[model samples]
Target: MTVRNLPPVSELTEQQQRGWSCVWCAAPLSTGTAINLGEQRHEPAFGSPYWWFPRACPDARACAKREVTGDRR
Candidate 1:
């Protein structure tokens, strides 16, 4: 699957709602097994960081990548 970037600078469309769909697997974002990368908050920001676009779910990672190699954080 091709990884696409969700541009944050653009206005939010109805499809952007959290309950809409996942960028990777097209699953509902509300699914218990799904996750969004933006939720991680890697960088400090007062507002929704524009750089944190194309939110991804945990299932987006490949099965081989599920195993942590070095960093747990």
Candidate 2:
């Protein structure tokens, strides 16, 4: 979806809300999902309407890398 015409996060349907996740990383997202609404100058397929969860947090990789990186503060 294009970010310029994307429906507001508040207007998302229940299914959409429940399905919200990082397409790339399969990360669970909440209302806390970061938003950057603006133009659609970039390719829409690259995640125009992106919602990112912190990569530095307790993700799948983090568990494996914890020994080296320790907990992200």
Candidate 3:
């Protein structure tokens, strides 16, 4: 199994960059108001590779934690 991650905004494809709202905080996205969190790809053998594009709001801070396994929120 292998996983591929997307590049920064400058290297993102046009389709990948097409977003009117932020993927993280639901903020208006534009050339000047977007925080590119890059894209990611989850590879699977059963179907097409799942592609994910995450964009953060201007006021949002960057943080990362381990993936939650169950209902811990």
Candidate 4:
């Protein structure tokens, strides 16, 4: 079997810009806010990428979970 690598967020199709929210806690993530994802904690990275979690928040776990679980509460 072969493993196919996925592209980075920079390469993915851009989605509509929306307010940042935590995947696990469903809390809104903003600048200087702390977001916990499993074993890691994330802080916001402000730059051209706009709103994004730090490297510690790999794979956008919170975002993915929301997609898969369809929790629009």
> Which numbered prediction scores highest in lDDT against the true structure?
3
After superposing candidate 2 on the true structure, give the runs of residues whose Cα lies further than 4 Å from its correct spot: 1-19, 35-73
lDDT of 2 by residue, 1-73 (tens): 3222333444444333344432223344444543323222223445556442222122435433542454322
Worst 10 residues of 4 by lDDT: 11-20
lDDT of 1 at 3: 50
On residues 1-73, what C-alpha lDDT tens digit does candidate 4 reach at each position? Answer: 1222322434323221122444332444553544332222223365443443321212355555765686643
Question: What is the TM-score of candidate 1?
Answer: 0.30
The 10-residue segment of model 2 with minimum total lDDT is 51-60
Candidate 4, lDDT over the whole model: 0.36
Off by over 4 Å in 3: 1-19, 44-46, 61-73
- Of the candidates numbered 2 and 4, which has the greater lDDT value? 4
- Expressed as tens digits, the lDDT of each residue in 13-35 for candidate 3 is 44445554554333445667666
Arranged by TM-score with the best first, the candidates are 3, 1, 4, 2
TM-score of each: 0.30, 0.22, 0.42, 0.25
Best by TM-score: 3
lDDT of candidate 3 at residue 64, scale 0 to 100: 15
Worst 10 residues of 3 by lDDT: 63-72
Ranking by lDDT: 3, 1, 4, 2
Tens digit of per-residue lDDT, candidate 1, span 1-73: 3455553423443344342454434344554655554532223346554333334445546421432332212
